[model samples]
Target: MLQRAFNKYIDNFRGFSREIWILTLITFINRAGTMVLPFLSKYLREDLDFSYNQVKWILISFGLGSIVGSWLGGKLSDKIGFYKIMIFSLMTSGIAFFGLQFVTSFEGLLVAMFFIMVVADMFRPAMFVSLGAYAKPENRTRALTLVRLAINLGFAAGPALGGLLIMTVGYKGLFWVDGATCILAILIFWIKVKEKKKSKYTDKEHPGEILTNSVFKDRPFWIFLGATLITGILFFQLFTTIPLYHKEQFNLSELQTGLLLTLNGVLIFFLEMPIVSYIERHKINKLKVITLGCLAMAISMYLLLVNQWAGILIIMMLFMTFGEMFVFPFSNSFAISRAPKGHEGRYMAIFTMSYSTAHILSAEAGMDMIRLFSYQNNWFFMGTLGIIGVLLFIWTMKLVKYEPPRNI
Candidate 1:
């Protein structure tokens, strides 16, 4: 079944193009290298002997670096082009991973983490901007869907293989693998990807004309940003809170937790294309799917707070997964519709920044609560947040004009 789907994805050249495939391939390779990150706190806490607070700082440092990287990458992508920007991002990110091999202190680890986030996030603005350039409105959702599936495919293999690598290669081994893939991805991009003359969007304005507020003045862009900012905040549970909950409350092994997270990726892989296609066929507004995403998360998370049983907790994961499937790709497609002339990279980068900012917010609010109350309480808090997110999503739909066709 999986093989057939893989072949179909390869053959379905309309939804995903050659550029999408190569870009996703590079993403897959790089993601496969860092699959060990799910295990990072374990290594930090158990091996390097860092505290929860120190690890929190690590997350924050990465978040901070990602903010700068995202802004710079988008800005640079606009100034130069996707090809040069992406190649540099890939290598810089890889070198940062390689640097992780030698880190002995918390400060060193934080620095490495920061740069890694910077470069990885930077590559994305370039890549997604490239994608936005290549695709049109009608097939855009499916295109983004395919890219996401490729990423999840990489993630599915990354953690499991990373576990094996850890057994044989140690913690530093993962970084080396990531670094190597970064180099390889860069080479592939240099050879296979070609930058064309700037698209209509890119060439609309003169160079250095980015700060013109007319682009930012789009009411739809502001609405979607608010929608995305809230969505990003709610999505934070997957990384920041879930692991802590598993350990502090459920007492699950690290292996079990890893598998659970992997399961989330699996859900995305199997369902993303079908869901996007179905919604597109129904002519359903993308905002509707995004709203359901928030609802799914809210229900599932609320269930987690209500149920004490581990089995139910696992089942509840499906809710969040289903919610995510609806919300993420659809919102991305929706956001792309809001971009103004010549600013696709900057717009998408703003969307990316929303998530980076959300993680920092989630960790800050969530960790303080965990420090005071229990993980169960944190679940309830997140559940509440999800509910609020759904309201925001509904409000977003009312405001944003998902009604119009994209600018061809």
Candidate 2:
């Protein structure tokens, strides 16, 4: 029985193109190098001696950079093609990692973080555009699931390695290793991936003409974006608030905290692809899947109220992981299904920007709540936000008439 189940899991990997596999490999390599961001809050609080407010501001800077980068990535992908934007983003951001080691002052560090995120985040929109271009319409969502599997697998490795690096050679080593990994991803991509040939469905407009297609002018998209931002605020707390909660509430060491997060990645790596495959095979409604995810996320936040209990913490992470598995990849599919021809980049960027915006709201608001009230209160607030997200998601779909775009 287990053998057949494992074979079914392997079946999901079949039928993808060479480019899709290459992109998945690139995603894995890039995500594996993502060592710095997960531990940035801890580094700021412990090593740099940042006040809660200062940490908040620094995170806001990172979010601001994400906003700029995600938008720019889309615009550039539409204008110059995904290739140039990706190569430039990867190479430049890799170099910036080395620079982060030298910045000490709060203002300087904030600026450094902003620049790193701006460069690093350019990969997202470009990557999605590439995914859309490479995968057949029917396989697009599954392809995305595969990419995310690569990401979660890499994430499962990165933090554990980061924990070891921190103990052996400090945060500076994290910077160096992460920088090298980005460069390595770039090398693999340059060698293995080629620009996809234009297909029958490809928009034939001039790149400049295509650039005129705008997401800001779409009302339904805004409703969707609003729902996305609400969910994102709660989802992003995994990176921002949860780490601090573990450190302060339980005095968990860096290794222990990294392991907690690793549990999230490990579960997703094992479960998400299979679950998505089953959903697709079973013809489940995407919106229903997403709503269930939002409710689960809200419940997870509430579970955090049972702080200092290791078993409860693990259970909370489990709920959060399952919620993310349901919410995030389907959200990508939802946006992609709605994208009009000649405007895929802009539509994707807007959706991506919702999470970027959440990073800003999540960090500043979350940290401030922890500082002013208690962490328990912060969890309650996050739970409330998640509940609001579930309502908004349901309403947003109804308001938009909920049709997938007819074209791939």
Candidate 3:
């Protein structure tokens, strides 16, 4: 029975095409090279000697660029194609990283950060559209989870490696390595991942047929997007406010912070795929899964209310990691499944916007909130946001129905 269960677990990873795996590999390579954003807050504060407000504004600029990039990527993916966009984003963003190494002044850093993020973020919607194009409906969630698995696995490596690199090569060296990895991922994607011509969505009409329906017209999706943005604002603190909290409240070093943050990726790397597979095979209600995930997130923040110790932080991260494992991949699959045929890029882009927008708000608002209020208050606010996220998902679930995979 144990062997059988193990085999079943292995089977979850089977059935995806070589292209899908290549796409997953591309995500992994890119994510593994993601050494910048996680450390940007710290770099701004300590290395660049910026104030709290300056750091917030710099990050906000990056967020604004992300918002633009997400929109443009989706629009351009539909018009041009995902492959071209992916290649361009990878190569140009790599160049941008190299360019960022030269910037010295605050204004220069902000401008460079904004452009780099803009180019880098263009990958999101295109990647989602390609995943939908490549995978069967029944395997969609697992496939998405597999990609996230690769991302988390890379994330597990990126920060820990980044911490080490900080001591060895400093921030500029980090950018150099990051740029090289993006270039490498681009090569793999260009050579290995082929474009597909088959219909990915349920519309029987031609690709041009559904182009008339804009994502703005999709009321249910907007409702879903709103909910996503709410959770996003709270969830993104993993990068911004949380790190600052560790620095100020706990007085932990960069290496220590990276390790603690790495705990999140470690949990996701080990558990996300199996759990998502189990939930998918068992035909569990996605709504229930999401609701539970949000509640878990809420509880994690509330747990932070009591202590500032490493033990409590780890416990809080455990709950948060579980919540992330449950929510993110399933949500991506949900967006893919709901996309209106040709409008997949737009639909997915709008969903991507939630995070991009959250990136905007989380830095500016979250930092300000922590400054004016306190870390304890921020935790309370995040907990409240999570509860609101739960209510939103419960409500949105009623408005939207999951369309099963169409065998093209």
For every candidate, C-alpha RMSD to the true structure in Å: 3.1, 2.9, 3.2
Error of 3 at 390 (Å): 1.2
**What's model 1's overall lDDT?**
0.76
What's the TM for model 1?
0.88
Which sections of candidate 2 miss by over 4 Å?
41-55, 104-107, 197-214, 246-259, 305-310, 400-408
Predicted candidate 3 versus true structure: per-residue lDDT over 53-140, tens digit per residue? 7887887888888888888888888777787888999999988888787886889978887788778888999998988888888888
Off by over 4 Å in 1: 1-15, 201-211, 402-408
Q: 1-408, model 2: which lDDT tens digit per residue?
A: 999988988997788999999899989988888999778888999998899889878887888999989988887776677777888999899888977888989989888888888888888998898899988887888899999889888887788789899999998899998888898898899888877643455466564444344355556557667878878888889877898788888888878887888788788877888888788878787878988998899999999999758688888988888999999888898887676554677778778888888878887789889989989999999999888888887886685555543432
lDDT of each: 0.76, 0.83, 0.80
Best by lDDT: 2
RMSD of 3: 3.2
lDDT of 1 by residue, 1-408 (tens): 999987764544455568777877777777776654777877888878999889878878978989988887887787777778888888877777787877869888788888778877888777877877666667777778887887788777787888888899788788788788888878887799787556665544454455355346666566667766766766777777777778877899978987887788887776678777777868887777888888888888778775467887678778878988988888777666666555666777887888888878887777777879977787788788777777777776675555465532
Candidate 2 lDDT (Cα, whole model)? 0.83
Which ten residues in a row are the worst by lDDT in model 1?
A: 205-214
Model 1, residue 227: distance off in Å is 3.0
